[model samples]
Target: MAASAPTLLSTTSRLRVSSAAAFRAATAPLLRGEASEWVVRGEATVQVLGRSVRVRLRKRLRMPATRMEEMRATDVSIERGDNATGVLTVASRVSFFSRSSLELVQMGALRVHAYYDAGANDPAVPAAERRARAGRLSSSSVRVGTVLLPNYELRAGYNELEEQIHFDQSLGV
Candidate 1:
C-alpha cells in the first residue's frame, strides 16, 4: 500500500497574571538588553521561528500613584534546550478591560520535535504520534515586541507555515 502524508494540528492558548510587576521583571532582560535601571510599561511582543505572540508590560517607575506611561511593549526570548527550542508564550491579558489595540493574541504553545526524514523514515506519518506542538498566527494579529517595538509584526497565520515556533522545555507549564 502506498504511504500517506504527515498531519499537523494547531490550538489556542492564553495566560494572565495579576502580578504585572513580576512579569515585567522576568521579561525585562529581552525588552531592554544591557541597560541598568531600565524599566518597561505597556504592550510589546516576541516572535519565535515565525509566529507572533502578543505581550503587554506595564511597570511603575515609582511606588507612588503618579507617573507617565512609564513603559509599554512586549519582550520575548528563547533558549535552546538539549532537545528543543521555540517561542515562549506568556501573557496577562484581561478580557473586556484589556487594551483595545492589543499587540497580539497568542494562539497556542510553540514546541520542538524530531522527525526522521520522510524519505529515510516511515512514509506513513503516524496520526497518533504527535511528538511536539506549536501555536499559529491568525490574520490581522499584531506582532509581539519589547523595548523598541518592531516596525512590522510577524506575518499573519504564520503557524500554518513550515515548522513554526520551536521548544523542548520540560517545565510542564
Candidate 2:
C-alpha cells in the first residue's frame, strides 16, 4: 500500500483572492449622462466571497503631436461565476476616448471608484493636471473592464510617449 502527500490548498485559495483584487482594479466608470468609460488590463478576472467574474478589454488609439489628446475605442466583455452558482455572462459594454491610462496605476486588487472627463466639462481644469491625466484621449489608448458594485478601475493609456512629447515640445516651443 502507498499514501499520497497532503494537498497544498492554500495556493488555490490565494488565486481566488488575487482574482477579486484584479477585477476591482479593472472597472472604473467614467460617466457623461450615458457615455461610460474605465480602464483594464490585457486579461483580468475577479472573485468575491464565492462569486467570480472574467473580464477583457481591447482598444485602438491615435494621438496627434499638436494636440494634448487622442482618440481611442475599446471593447469590453465579462463572465461571472460563483462557488454555489455556475458561470454566466454578467456584463459587457464599450467605452471610447479616455484620458487616463491603466498602465500608470499600480496593480493589486483595490476597492476603488473613480470619475473622469474626456472633455473639458470644467473650464477650471488646470493645464498641468489635464496633461498629466492625458485627458481628451490624447494618448490614443484603450481599456476593457468588468465590475461588481462598490467601484474599481484600471487605466488604459493610449499614447503615453506622444503625450510626453507633446509636453516636452510645449516646454521647448
Candidate 3:
C-alpha cells in the first residue's frame, strides 16, 4: 500500500502537468486569432404581443477565435439570470394595426459547439490568402417563429481605428 501511494502521487502529478499542456495546445490557435465557428442551441421564454411564448433557438455563428473567447469572457460576468446584457439582441417588425413587441422573459440554458480552424494561422500563407481560407469567418443565423430571420452582422474585437476593444451586436429579421 505504501508503494502504491507514491505511485499514485507521481501519476497524479504527471496528469496535472499533461492536462495543463493540453489546454494550452488546444487554445493556442484561438490565442493566435484563428477563425472559429459556434453553433448555439438554447431554450427561452419570450413575450410577444402580450402573450408568453416558448422557443427553441438554434443559432450558428462564426468569427475570429479570439473574439469568441472575449465574448465568452464577457458572458462570465453576466449579472442577470433571465436577461442577458447585450449577449442577445432581438428585433421584430411592427405591423400596421397592432403594435408588435418581443421581449425575452427567461433563458433556460445554452449548449454551444465550438470549432477552431487552425489552418488559418499558417505562417507561410499570406494574410489575404489566410482570410480567403477562412471564408465567411464572421456570420450568424437564427430562426424566429416559423421563419428564418436574416442576420445583421457585427463583430467584437480590438478595433485598430478605435484603439480599444469594440463589441457590436444587433439582430434583425
Against the true structure, whose TM-score is highest?
3
Scored by lDDT, the top model is: 3
TM-score-best of 1 and 2: 2
Compute the lDDT of residue 33 as modeled in candidate 3.
Answer: 52
lDDT of 3 by residue, 1-173 (tens): 34223222221121112254554454345434565543445678999999999987554534235422222122122222223432332233311111111111122221222334455676876898666655223333222212112321122322111111112132221
Colliding residue pairs in candidate 3: none
Alpha carbon lDDT at 34, candidate 2: 24
The reply for model 1, stretches above 4 Å from the true place, is 1-11, 32-173
**Residues forming the 10-long window of minimal summed lDDT in candidate 1:** 62-71
The CA lDDT at 125 in model 2 is 74
Q: List, residue by residue over 2-51, the lDDT tens digit for candidate 2.
A: 12322322212222223645433333322221223322225568786888
lDDT per residue, candidate 1, 1-173, as tens digits?
11133222122222354475675554343222222232334566889689998876543321111111111222323323243433343322111111112222332322222222332223363533322211222332233321111122212222112222332233332
Residue 55 shift from truth in candidate 3, angstroms: 0.9
The alpha-carbon lDDT assigned to residue 165 of candidate 1 equals 33
- The TM-score that candidate 2 achieves is 0.17
Every model: Cα RMSD to truth = 22.6, 20.4, 22.5
